[model samples]
Target: MDINIRRAVIHNVSENNQDQLRDTIVDAMQKGEEKYLPGLGVLFEVIWQNADEQEKGMMLDTLENGLKQT
Candidate 1:
């Protein structure tokens, strides 16, 4: 097994490298809008599509109780 990383190259990066990483990520996301997820939409879609009868009953009970607190 072998692994290699250039520590000196990493250390040479500018002082603002944290912000540089954030900017790079933002740029990548701007370039890939179609790949981004809306969190709640994905959650509900998975629950609706895959839940069994037992799971559906439990989920409805949880949701009903959850709504009463709001």
Candidate 2:
């Protein structure tokens, strides 16, 4: 079977409102399920693509700090 996960993720959430998106993210994280990782990754990809330089820098900084703790 052929599947485009990024496209599927985008299509699934394209119409979601802010609260709904927040809930979806929170639910996925709280579940701590490996299956949710791909969706989260796709969401992060969209965020990365749309983010301005400063936003991307901030994300990188946050990730750096997160990794430092682990």
Candidate 1 stretches with Cα past 4 Å from truth are 1-38
lDDT of candidate 1 over 1-70, digit per residue (tens): 5532233223433354668756745665677765433332343554577889999989899999999999
C-alpha-based local distance difference test score of model 1: 0.57
> Which residue pairs come into collision in candidate 1?
none
For candidate 2, list the clashing residue pairs, or say none: none
Off by over 4 Å in 2: none
Winning candidate number (lDDT): 2
Question: Each model's TM-score, in the order given?
Answer: 0.42, 0.94
Cα lDDT of model 2 by residue, 1-70, tens digit: 9999999999999999999999999999999999999999999999999999999999999999999999
- How many angstroms is residue 68 displaced in model 1 relative to the true structure, after the best TM-score fit? 0.5
